[model samples]
Target: MPPIPTPLTLTQLLNPPSRDGLLTQIVSMLSGLGFSATDWETDSDGRIILQVEAQTLADLWQAVYKIAQGGYLDTATGDWLTLLAQSQYQLTRNPPTQTIGEFRLTAAGGVGPYTFNKGDLVVTYFDPTQNNKALIYRSTNAAPVVVNPGTTRSIQVTADSPGSAYNIAPGSVLVLNTPRPGLTVDNQGTLQPAVATGAILNGPFFTAGQTLIVTSALNGGAAVGPTTFTFTADYPDMTSVANALNVLIAASPQAGRITANVLNGALSLSTILITGATAVDQITIANTGTANISVGFDTGSATSVSGAYSWISEYGQDNESDTSLITRCINKWATIGTGTKAAFISWATSADPDVQKVAVYSNLFNGTPKAGAVTLYIAGIGAFDIVSGPVHANNVYAYIFPKLPIMTELFVAPAARNTKDVVFTAKIKTQYNNDTTKNAVFNAVQNLFFRLTIGETLYKDQVIAAIITIPGIVDATLSAPGIVSDIVPAINELITLGSVTPNWLVVV
Candidate 1:
């Protein structure tokens, strides 16, 4: 490994003389040799010949300067920087990718089996903050049909562009851009799962001891059933296994005709409440012995559902900036041995574009040291919080898995949030609208917190400094953080703006 070179600005590395300066020097040299300086004047034809020739020579030198700059690391940009990153360190800029998620569209009152074609769009309501710009999500499913009237169907949609500004918080994306008659959309964040309310058995009953229990919330007089069955996996929850669990419930008393509080989305067998088949304790197949199956599902309600707002999956990134590519190229060289701190960060940073701040805790968990263990606390652009979610953590872990050294254990989690509300009173300039000034102050504080990294300390004065810098704010004072000091977070924690309450006082 070669030693890193000293950093130098473009102007410092090369001083390309201006054409006028070069021309003046050329005239000065000619005049010193007894030639008339007036001959090179801009107004005369003789001047055009000598001056233009001098300018041409200067232009060639400037071109040479820029071409020479392309050979260096810090001063290079555009294609020059791209080649440096590629050739010297096997790296390339990440192209922009759109955010995509599976969203559910429910009909208000429809005929049957409505198709949301692959290119169909579901858009968020217009936002006042973003100059009334709305996020548009185009359906990716070839044919997402709602078979039954008034049923909800899941359609995968991709954002028109990768903008993570408004669709991150739960219920933040409730409004639709345009109304589709008899159809409504729900775009949620970090969801548990959609409710598969009523369940029923379709075929012959299960063998003896096979019971279908409903443990989900009882909406519209639906009762919570016995807690007889345990969940198969802890992460996926009941909804993911709903399809499989619904198929295995062939003996439940509730078989078909489930029609109460329906999300009208996916089919949950437990939500099926048909009443035709006789309850059998034991049933045998043609060549099989008595079957035993105990299937139970939660008709539980949803808070955060699978939506376009989750930002849970891929963090679609725009093309890498020149500054970022150069830094990554330099960092790439540090990852040669593959177990260094740089290796982990380089891998995680490359995972997605939203990945802004990543804190690496080597040989430590909960502040306790454990040999051969690495815990990565990551925070990125996400709905509801800056911290990365389980899905993202899993994806990051998978990306870093192949790069780990022998016998190294790795754990990845979203950075814990240290939320703080900013409470202050600001004297607003009389000309500025009180509401507008208040909103600006709030945004100023929030934007500051958003830019902070994991384990960074937030100075109370810095917060006050940020608010006062707003053009509308005449004067401001911080009160809630009564002591007036810096708020330091744990290494694995990120400071997030919870709420901003600015008491505005108008001043002439």
Candidate 2:
């Protein structure tokens, strides 16, 4: 039998040199240039790797790296040195994104014509001292707004901060204010339907000399004086009378910020910027009509007030980060080819910009199907886009589901390990702690098991080993059913942990 030939080191490669290939020659050249080289896992391409030593690692790596990069060595030879410096130079690229946040404004004063000037809104929160994070929004083209009176509008604003997008805590108060030159109000007056057919006062019969006084209050502005509109003719149709009153409000200088239209044979009034919470109060509708004229939707025959105003809070997110973008770029590169289930799963779980958790199964779990059918269950913040179209790039028999059923089961506490003693700090002594070590363990284990493609073993000892790292955890054990030595799942099934009780985190 022929004896195995010995491998050449950096020293041997440069000496009395026999024909030993380009790798040796490359190392010999690097040696002359005051750089050390070592053979680290040879490939079809002869790439000479630098040894991991303090002096040569930094100074020599830098000097020899310049030599390789001086265009002396081939491209393949430089790649090995490049890999060695991976820790120094990150390959991640920044992504182009805008930080998007929103404020939900709900208008009151029933069936309104709420006008929100695009540039009128100013929102401030999340460490107000850091004023750079404040978000301001307004109408783009016009001073007033185009909006449905009786609805909620979500105003999206682009915000910026020193670093990444600001993650505002949920339920944080979104203090909203406006400084536009207009009175904001929640004062509203709705028209009652017609009861009869007539040219004036059509809905209800109004005798001659009848009167309705319209009054409004402004937000941080002057009080709008009441305007009186009287019927000139006797027993006129509701339309003519309502029209006359609308004309009266529209023409009056005091009613400059108010408008009235005859809706369903009754007068419907809308105040400009006045809101209920700001000021806009004392909205009285007086009926000075003779012979008891009927007012529609008015609690009584004389006066009525507007409803109270309210608002809801919502959160916004900042733009993508450099790290997240690099992860996405790599994932996109990974999924560019034939869209196999594995490729799709990789994109969904790790690559797709939005997806965070995913599980892919070949066999049927939700419903029965052919042997080759594939199903994917995924979840994340706005991760529905991945499944909006096709599940796989090329496969036609794949189905995507929104949420997979969470498998819930209790695991008994591990048996007391009397042989060994473990010690942890007081923080992890509680069943559940703010430190989140337990949650981290649960998530890590879940990631290993709850995946699209299954056939992985869940070892009880592995979980126990993870939990033991928490502070104040003296000891831990794994009992049967909940967790044993190991449990192998079927190709179609995925395991999810529902909860872990305090009894399970035992100490001997």
Candidate 3:
């Protein structure tokens, strides 16, 4: 094998064999290029200084020389220095950066140009109930207030100030991600009011000696008494009896819990308005009476209230820090034209902070061409758009395709937001006897799944290891998939443990 090639760096080129000796080597490298290193020094700040002799006959030379005097290297020199700097930056840096993910935006019950201001927040998560606590970001652009109608352009922004670091992975759920500082124009927000149901009795009204039983158990509902209704005196018309029964049920102890009314000579029951934390479920009505009375939803039905908002369109990016840029520059140099499964995966995961998992399969699925086609399967945390604007399919192709040898074709697979289940069953023994202990164990199991990425492996041992780390879980065993093995999926498959089912008991 050929000897490993050492990088040509200023530090190495200026080796202290004597200042004259180093200057001679630099001059030799620049001799034919019309540039020469004349003098060098180390500043009090520890920055190395090098004075270069350049041919300044043209306007380009004049411009470059002036810029170089401002402490920045000339374009040619800067490019070379960047290449050298990247070689060493790998070991020191390489932290992930948040990507400018793309998403769609549409008006559900409103008009056009749903505008948002700078610092408008948006979020993605594995769970929806936890609000403003997921991967939160803000809009960087704030102009023309009335933006266009399409995908909302947004960048991953943090509330973090300088000197601190924050990171988020790609393939994070971008679709349906809640946009903060919601659209205030035209009263468009992220939430909508809940509606109640009103149903009519299609069958005949209550007859004499007939009884009706009502039970409420819908949407965290309470139990309504199975009240019996009977006619006091002989009645020619039963409509008044239905009205009387409606009044009776309406005035019952379950008034705020539920309500009943008579509409169009039919008994109408509706769920009363509850607080945001509470909701109403379907009520059960049984007829123990002799007459048959049919019941169903009325003309205007009550629906559980919900909120809707616009999708994200376009995309934006946060400003990359100097360290990140330098790391990227180095990666570009090291992996240029290097296309392989491993190389591509590394390149993609490093492409942006948001990209959590990646799978690349060559000639796996064929279409037009018989062979030489490679597809990259990428997934993020919550959601993200793969093809749009700068970070689209073509950009991905450039990163992987060029790296592959000639005659091999590369294609970026269509972005898939769906997640596959990585199920597991565990039995745990806890030391504590408190009610919260069991909950804590379950939470620990779920947390393991939440931390899993798209292409990450779900090892049985790792699961048990995680359980043992918890305070209450003294001993745990894998019960479901008894054999210990890794959940290794293909490159294109994005899998997640939706939930963990555990059979646990407290120990004395």
TM for every model, in the order presented, reads: 0.56, 0.30, 0.34
Q: Which ten residues in a row are the worst by lDDT in model 1?
A: 280-289
Q: Per-residue CA lDDT of candidate 2, range 177-268, in tens? A: 55322223210111111011111123434535655565665443555655665654543455555566556676675465555454334344
Q: Could you give candidate 3's per-residue lDDT for residues 1-508 as a string of tens digits?
A: 1111276444333322333444355456665567533333434221132212112123333453434432322222333334444454332233333433223244433345566555553544332222223444455553623444433333323322221111221212332344323322110111111112122223344355655455554344456565454444333343555565566566665556555444333343444544442222334444343332323221111111111111222222334344444544444545644655656765765655445445666663211222675556554432233223124333455555556777775545323222222233433444454334444444454456446654466677776776677665677776532224666643333433322345555564
Question: Which candidate wins on lDDT?
Answer: 1
lDDT of 1 by residue, 41-124 (tens): 468886777668777877776776777777778788888778877777777776666766656677765554566566755566
Cα RMSDs, all models: 12.9, 23.5, 20.9
| Ranking of all predicted structures according to lDDT, beginning with the best and ending with the worst | 1, 3, 2
Local error of candidate 1 at 96, Å? 5.3
lDDT of 3: 0.40
**Steric overlap count per candidate:** 22, 32, 31
In candidate 2, stretches whose alpha carbon ends up further than 4 angstroms from where it belongs are 1-96, 99-101, 106-114, 117-119, 127-153, 160-164, 167-170, 177-342, 348-352, 365-369, 379-508
- Give the total clashing residue pairs for model 3: 31
